[model samples]
Target: MSLTDQLMTDMKVAMKGHDKVGLSVIRMLKSALMNKKIEVGHDLTTTEEQQVVVSQMKQQKDSLVEFQNGHRDDLVAQTKEQMAVLDKYMPQQLSESAIRQLVQQTATDIGAESKADFGKLMKAVMAKTKSQADGSVVNQIVKEVLS
Candidate 1:
């Protein structure tokens, strides 16, 4: 089933089970997806749907960190639950070593010898990794590889 279809199914299940948190997360995701669809003025492709999920996951992670820093345990727990719900839709994340290897190999392939080639290296690596790797992790790997 498509992600949206799966989400709708899960939302119904959540409603029947009285899973308030799960229902809330699903509703939030649906809203984000609809907004993204409207923004692009078309139905989201599979890749675009994944991008929307990834973007929402990123926002949740950022909020989790902020909540932790502020010692807001309740918000932190809620954010973590939301993240868990969103995680079901995200592609498997790359490990640090995997990202490093990808950056190293791509750098060599593109003849990226120094930081001067940062942009080129990043473009190539990001193209390969797409939603599988985090941008900050890829950036660090590229920097480390180039240095």
Candidate 2:
């Protein structure tokens, strides 16, 4: 089944199991998936669905950072739970060493020898690495490799 379908199924199970937090997060995810479908006036491809899931995961990561900074351990824990749920739906994430290797290859493939070529190299690298690695982490890797 597709990611969206799996999410819908899990939503039902969460509700039946009386999992409040899980239900809420799954509901929000379903709503986001539906919204994208509505925007495009059609169902999303697996890639599009993955993109939406990844976007939600990114938001949770940001929220976790803010919640921790604000000393809201409760919120931080909640966000972390949601993030873990989100991660299960994603493909295997690249290790740091793998990402660094990809960054180097991407730079070489694009002939990016200097900082001026950073943008070009990053575009290609992110195309391959998106959803597998965080943007900020990817950016730092690109900078280090290119520098």
Put down candidate 2 lDDT per residue, 1-147, tens digits, no spaces. 988778879988988999887888888888998999999999898878878888898899889889999999999988888877777777667899999999998887889999999899889998998677778889999999888
State the local distance difference test value for candidate 2: 0.86
Summarize candidate 1's per-residue lDDT along 1-147 as a digit string, tens digits: 888999999999999999998999999999999999999999989888888889999999999999999999999988998888888889788899999988888888889998899999999999998789889889888888899
Q: Which stretches of candidate 1 lie over 4 Å from their true place?
A: none
Pairs with steric clashes in candidate 2? none
The runs of at least 3 residues in candidate 2 whose Cα sits more than 4 Å from the true structure, single-residue gaps closed, are none
CA RMSD, predictions in order? 1.3, 1.4
CA displacement after TM-score superposition, residue 126 of candidate 2 (Å): 0.8
Cα lDDT for residue 66, candidate 1? 94
Q: How many backbone clashes are present in model 2?
A: 0
